[model samples]
Target: MSKLKIGLIGANGRMGKAIIQVLAQSQKSSLSSATVKAGSVYIGFDSGIHSGIKETGVIFDSDLVAACKGSDVLIDFSSHTGFSENLSIAVAEKKPIVIGTTGLTEAEKMEIQTASTQIPIVFSPNMSVGVNLLFKLTEIAAKVLQEDFDVEVLDIHHRHKKDAPSGTAQHLKEVLLRAFDRKEENVIYGRHGMYPERDPKEIAIHTMRAGEVIGDHTVFFLSPEERIEISHKAQDRKTFAVGAVKAAEFLSDKSKGLYNMFDVLGI
Candidate 1:
């Protein structure tokens, strides 16, 4: 069988470089094209060499449309600024896309929902398999603990990461909300001065940006009797890259649908 050709966006970012390395070592897929911002210095550079690997003859460019047209599937790790354009080009070119971008606004998320009716899309905030499992475990714990346990989430990432609370942390928040049948109003960001007492139904998310930590998240459920904590720590960016490649491969033959890492992992 022919290897699936993958087009990558934001080929100059950290995740992009990791994906390029993964593709170079993949037996089921190959990097067909890579895109950077228009007029950027990285344009015209070999994707492999830019990613610190041996040459693979795939050059970086800024033409998203051409990249979509030339590959069997697309993987976008670009910033939220170019997310709509990348998504639009994928829909226009009738190509499946695996979206790993975060920090998208609600409107951009709605755009993805609308576009999924026309083409297959694997949209996920965190693509690490371990993180997804953390999501599942948190849900289970929430269901079992109910309102008896006070819940709080801790998210830690590299200082260079732009978004607060990380997308993975937000997803963990969503999972808790769903499990408890609560609304967005029931969530809290962090605590400040003294209050009367903690709300049993309130879910708290705390974020910390420290030196060079890839990613770390822990969901804590505390009761008067005991405490339960479920966590996942990412040691390398390649974990997410592997899952992104798997998501692209999952969309290789699908026509139209909105899917997530749960779908890709069959969880």
Candidate 2:
């Protein structure tokens, strides 16, 4: 069987390089093309060499559509702005995409949803298997604990990360809200000067960005006598890259629709 051809966006980025390294070793897929931003230093260079590996003869291109021309699927870890444009390009090319970009607005998310009707898309905030399982465990805990415990979410990331509260943190909020049957407005971002006592109807989320922390998330379920903490700490970027590669492999043979890590992992 032919290897699944993969075109990668953000090819010179940390996650992109990580994915390329994994794909290089995988017997199931091949790196067909790689794309970086226009005028990038790595443009026109061999994708593998740019990613700190031996040359693979796949030159880094500037045009996303051109890079994805013959791919079975495209994996994206680019910025929100870059993805917004590439989303249209992917749709135009009728290519499947696994998107790992975060911090998208509600409207931008809607755009992805709309496009999924026409193509296969596996969109995830954190694509680490452990993190996805953490999501499941958090949901199970929320269901059992119910209203008896006050829920708080804490997320930490590297200083260079662009978004606050992290997409994984926000996704945890969604999972809790679903398990509790609560609405969006019921979540509290954080506390500041002079506020009333904690609201039982709300869950609090706190975010921290500091020195080179890959990613860490903790969900605290606090009660009168005890506190139970469910946490997942990412030691490095390979976990996410591997999960995304798995997502790409899963989506390669699927029909048009929207999917997530749950669909990929069958949890």
Candidate 2 positional error at 23, Å:
0.8
Model 1 pairs whose backbones collide = none
TM-scores vs. true structure, each candidate: 0.99, 0.97
Worst 10 residues of 1 by lDDT: 193-202
Q: Which candidate leads in lDDT?
A: 1
State candidate 1's TM-score. Answer: 0.99
lDDT of 2: 0.92
Cα lDDT for residue 121, candidate 1: 96
After superposition, which runs of candidate 1 have C-alpha atoms over 4 Å from their true positions? none
Residue 185 of model 2, lDDT score:
88
Per-residue C-alpha lDDT of model 2 across residues 117-179, encoded as one tens digit per residue: 999999999999999999999999999999999999999999998898899999999999999
lDDT of 1 at 91: 92
